[model samples]
Target: MFFEILKNLRKKFKRLYITMFKNYIIFVFLMLLVLSGTIGFMIFSIGKMVSSEDYIKDTQKFFMASKIVKSDYKKIDASKIVASKGWVEILNSNKKVIYVIGTKKDKVTSYTENELLNFMDLSYNNLKSGTSYFYSVTAFNSNGEDLYCIVKVPPGIVTLNVDIAPSPDKYIKKAAIYILVGIFIIIVFLTVSVFLYAYLTTKKVVMPLKKILQGIKRMTEEDYSTRINFNAENKFGEIRDAFNFMAEKIEASIFERNRMENLKQQLLSDISHDLKTPLTSIMGYSKALNDGVVENDKKIKQYLNIIYNKSKRTVSLIENLHEFTKLDNSKFLISKEECDFCEFVREIVSEYYNEFEEKNFELEINLPEDEIIYEFDKVEMERAISNIISNILKYNEVGTKAKIELTYDNSKIQLIIADDGVGIDESLKENIFEPFVRGDKSRYTKGGTGLGLSIANKIVQKHGGTLTLEKCKKYKTVFRLKL
Candidate 1:
C-alpha cells in the first residue's frame, strides 16, 4: 500500500500542474501575505488598546472639571457646567444636590449623595445602573465645604482626566480611519511586491519551457536545424544542451537518409543504361544465329562468340549489382580473424602475378619485413584488394609498372597501390569512388564495370578503415588504403 502511494506521488510529480520551482515561489508569497495581514491586525489592535486607555483618562478629567464649581453651585452657569455629549452634578458635604446639567437630569437628581457615593465605591457597571449613566466622581473643596462631583461621559468620547476637552469621537474616528488606511496601504504595497517578485521569478523558471515549445514547433515543421542556444545556470540548461544534441543527431540522420535515397536512384538509372547495350547485342546476334541468317561456319562461330561475350558481361553486371546492394544494406557482417598483415597481402599479390605478366606489366613489391598481426575480415579485405589489382590490370597499358607498398604506423596499417596507367581525369577525381562513375568514357568497353573502386572503398570502410585515391596525375595513379 505504501509503494502504491509512492508510485502515485511520483506520477503526480511528473505531470505536475506547476513546476517545483514555481510552486515554491507561490508558497513563499502566500506565507508573506499571511504575515503581512497578521502584522496589520496587531497594529490596529494596539491602537484600539491605546484609545481605550485614553477614554478612561478623559473621564477622570471631566470629573475634575465638575469639582471646580463653588459649593453654592451658583458661580458656574448651568449651561457651561456641561461636557460634550455629557452632564455634570455637584453635591455639598451635607449630601444635598447642588445642580444638574445635560441629558435627563431626573436620574442624577434622584440619586442621594450617599447612594451615589456607594455606587462609586461599587464596580463601574453598578455605578452606571444607580445613576443610569456612565460617569466619574471626584472630591473637591468649594466655599470651604467638601463636595462630591459626578460627571457623565458620552459613549462616543473616551473619559480622559487630562482636561474637560471636546468629544473624542471625531478625533478617534479620524485616527481609526488613518490606521485602517495605513493597514490597507501596507497590504497593497506588500501584495504588489509579492506579485512582482512572483512574476519575475516564475518568468525565469518558465522561459526555458517556452523555448522548448518553440523548438518542438520548429521540429514539427521539419526544421531540424532549430536549436536552443541558451547556457543557463540551472537544470534547464542541461535540458537545452540535450535538445541541441538531439537536433544535431536528427539532422545528420536525415541528411544520410537523403544521400542514400539519391544513391539508390542513380544506381537504378546506371544499371538500366549499362544493361541495355549488352542485352541488345545478345538478343540480336542470337536471333540471327537461330534464323540461320549466318550460313558459313566461320560466320556462325563469330556470331556465337559475340553472343557469349555479351551474356558474360551481363552476368558480371548482375553479380556486381547484387554485391553492391548487400554491402549497402548494412546486413552483411565481416568474418574477422587475426592474421599477419604482410603475409595476407603477399598471398593475394602472388595470385595476381600471372595477370600482371599477361598484361606485360612490371610488378614491384615494397613491404616492411615486420610481422604485423592485425584483426580483419580476410575474405572481404582480399576482395577489396583484388578489385584494386583488377583495375590496374584493366586500365593500365602494356608495359605499365604496378607497385604494392605496405607499411605500418603505431595505430594503423597502410597499403599503397601505385600504377603507371592511363590515370583518372581531374574531372572524375571528385566522384571517383561513387558507383558506376567511369573516367575517360573509354573504360566502359575496356572490360571494366566502374564499380570496382566504389565496392573496394565500401569493403574497407566496413573493416573500420579508409581507402582514397591519393593521386591521379597524367600517367600515375595512386590509391591509399588505411586500416
Candidate 2:
C-alpha cells in the first residue's frame, strides 16, 4: 500500500510537472499576481485601520467647543429657539460654514449645518413631548454666509450661537476620494509593473530554457543530429551547464548502446555470411552429385540424395539466419521513388498471391482507387510487409484469416494488417515485438528470429511513419501503420 501510494504520488507529480511547470512564464505570471494582490490588500487594510470617522461624538464635541463661546455650561437662555434670522446671536451672526462653537463643554463641537439639521430633528423629536424646557444651539461667524448649526432649548426656547471655521471633514472626504483614486492608479500600475517585472525576469530564464528543453526532447526522440546552443553567464548559465551535461550524458549513452548493438549485429552478419557461402557451395556440390553424377548406383545414389537433401535443409536454415541477421544490421538504406501508393500495393499483392495461398492463409485486401502519390522505397516496404506476412503464416493455425487495408484521408496514409491467430498472452504482450521474442516459445517450427518486427518498425520510422500493434487477443492480432 505504501509503495502504491508513492507510485501514485510520483505519477501525479510527473503529470503536473509536464502540464504545468513545463512553461516557466506561467509560473512567473502567477507569482506577480500573488505578490501584487498581497501588497494591495496590505495597503488597503492599513488605510482602513488609520481612517478617521467623519462625524462621531469626538468630532461633534470639537466643533461645538470651537464654535459656541460664552454659552458653555452657563445659565440656560430661553424664548429664542425659532425667531429665525440669527435669533441666537442676533445680528452678530457672520461665520460662513461654522464648524465648532466656543461652548464650555465639548458636547457638540464638530456640528456642521447639514449635521445640524439632523441634530435639530432629533432634539425636536424629544421636545415634541411638550417638555417643560430644552436647549438648542446655532452657529455663525463675524460675516456668516455659507454654513452654521442652530440648536434650540425648546419650551424654554433658548438658542445658542457658535463661531468657528468649518472642520476639515469636507476636505478630508475629498482627500479620501483622491487617495482612493490614487491607490487605484497605483494598483493598476503595480499590477502592470509586477507582470512586466515577471516577464522581464522570466524571459531571461524561460525562453532559453524552453529552447533547450525542445532541443533535448527532439534528441531523445532519436534526432541525435539536432544541435542546440543556449549560452548564458549567470544562473541560467549554470542551468545551461546542467542541461548540456544531461544532454551529453544521454547522447553518449545512446551512442554507446547503439554502437554496441550494431557491433553485435555486425558480428552476427559476418558469421552468417561466412557460414552461408560455404553451405551454399556444399549444397551445390551435393545437388550436382545426386542429380547428374550418381544416376544408377542405388546405395551411392541414395547416400548422395540424402546428402543433397540435408545440405539443402542446412542451406535454407543458414539463409534464414542470415536474413534475420541482416534485419539486425539494418545498414541498408532505401532508394526512394515517388509512386502511386495504391498502385504499388496492388502490384505487390498481385505478385505474392501464390505465397499466401500456399500457407492456406485466407487473404483479404483493400485499397483506395484514388491516385495518391508518396515517396517510398519499394524494397524497404516489401521487406517490412513480407516479414509481417511471414509472421502471420508461421504463427497462425491452418486456414487462419488475414487482412491488408490501405486508407488515406487528410493527406495521411494508413496501412492496417490484421490476422486471426493465437494472439499474445496478456502478460507478455508488451515485449512480444522485441528482438528475438516469439509469439510461441514452446516450439521452434516458425524459426521465429525476433528481428522481423523490430526491423519493420525501423523501416516504417525511416519512412516518417509509425508502426503500432493495434490489438492482440486470443483470436487475432492487428498491426497499424500510420503516415
Candidate 3:
C-alpha cells in the first residue's frame, strides 16, 4: 500500500521529479569527488609528515636508548646517546652528574634532589644556555647499582614521552595500504551510484521523446488527426498542447477542402443537366420544322414559338450562370449610393404589382412612412429583391398571398419577403441558398435554372448585407434581408 501511494505521487509530479533528481545526482557526484580528493590529500600530507627522515630517525634513536637503559645502564654508549645538536647525561643515586657527552652548556655538575626531580618531571627551558630541551629519563639497576640516564634533545630535533614503532618504514607501508583500500571502496560505490542515476534520468527523458516522435511520424503519413497526449509540467506540456492545436486546424482544413471539391463536382453535374434539357428541346423542334413534319400553318407557328421559347430559356440559364460567376469573382465591387430605402422598396414592389395582378396573386406591402435612408447599389439591390418575388410567384398557386415588409433602425435595415404557399422542402432548408439546390423534383419540370436564390445571396453579400431564409409564424416561407 505504501509503495502504491509513492508511485502515484511520482507519476503526478514526474517532470519535477526528473529535474530535481538530475540535479541531485550531479550534486552527489561532485561531493563525492571533492570528498575523495580531500581524503587523499589529508592522507598524503600525514604520510609526508610522519615518514620524514628526521622524525623517523628521532623515533628510532629514542627507542634504542630506552632498550639499552632498561637492560644495562653501564652498556650505554655516549657517542650514540646525543642527537646532532643535543646532549646526554648520567647521574648517580646521589643526584649528581657523573658522566656527560656532547655539548653540555649547563654549568651545574652537582644537583639537589629537588633540582634533579624537576629535570625529570618537566621539559626544562634553561635560561643560561638559552636552549629548550625535551627530556626522557630511564632508571635502571646494574648489579644492584642505581643510576639514571637522561636523553635530552632540542625541541626541534626530536619528540619525547610518546610511544612509536621501531620500524618507521613498515608502519608507513601498512598505513598506506589501508588508505588505498578505503579510497578504492569509495570510488567503486560512487561509480555504481552514478551509473544508476544516469540510467534512471535517461529513461525519464527518452520515454516522452519517443511518444512525440511517434506522433510526428503518424502526421507525416498524412494522419492530420494525430495528437500527442503528454502530461508534464515542463516544456513537454507546452509541446503537447501546441501539437493538438495544430492537428485540429489541419483536420478542419482537410475537411473543408474535401467539401469544396465535392461541391464543385455537383455544380458541374447540375449545370450540364439544366443546359442539356433546353438545348435538346430546341434541337427537336427545329429539326421537326426542317424535316417538314408539321404541315398546318398554325401548328408550324406553334412549333416555331416552342423553339424560340426553349432557346430563350437556355440563354437565360447561361446569363444567370454568368452573373453568378461574376459575383463570385474576388475583384467584383458594387457601386453604392445613398437613397431612401423605403421609396426604393416601394418602386420595386410597384413594378411587380402588374405581374401579381395578372397572376391573380394576393399582394401585401408594409413600408414605413418615414424615409429610411441607406447606401446600396440600386441595380444589384433591385435584382436581389426581384429574384425573391419571382421565386415566390414561380412556386406558388395563383391565389397565394405574397407580402413585403421593410423595417430599419439606426444600425441596420431589414427587408422581409413572405408568402402563404407550398413551403420549401425540409431537406433543402439547410442549403437553400447554395447554387443548384431546388425545392423538389418538380423544380426541374417547372423550368428553373436553380440559381435565383444563390444569385440573390451573392448580390446581398457583395453589398455587405446578409440574405437568409427564416421561420415566421404567419407565413409558410420567409426570406429576410439585412443591410
What TM-score would every model get versus the actual structure? Answer: 0.57, 0.44, 0.56
- lDDT score of model 3? 0.77
Worst 10 residues of 1 by lDDT: 155-164
Answer with 1 or 3, whichever has the higher TM-score: 1
- Which model scores highest in TM-score? 1
Cα lDDT for residue 2, candidate 1: 24
Model 3 per-residue lDDT tens digits across residues 319-420: 999988999898989899999999999998988888899889888888999988888999988888998998888888889888899988877999999998
TM-score-wise, the better of 2 and 3 is: 3
- Predicted model with the maximum lDDT: 3
Q: Cα lDDT for residue 167, model 1?
A: 60
Q: Candidate 2, residue 280: CA error in Å?
A: 14
Error of 3 at 405 (Å): 1.9
lDDT of each: 0.74, 0.60, 0.77
Per-residue accuracy of model 1 over 1-483 as CA lDDT, tens digit each: 323533543454365445765777877788678767767675776567556755555433434444344555556443533545666676767666666655644543456657777746754333332344456666777767788767665534443232434466755676677677766776787788779877855665567678866886897788989898654665566657766777788899999899879978988888998899899999899889889888999999999898889899989989888877788778788888999999999999999888888888888898888888999988878889999988888877899978899998886899999987788888998888999988668898886777878889999999989998866452378899999
**Model 3 CA deviation exceeding 4 Å by range:** 1-214, 227-242
Write the residue-wise lDDT of candidate 2 on 162-276 in tens digits.
Answer: 2112255664676566567656766787688779767865676567667766875786586755555666665455545655565676678889899779857865774565456
Off by over 4 Å in 2: 1-332, 424-428, 446-448, 472-475
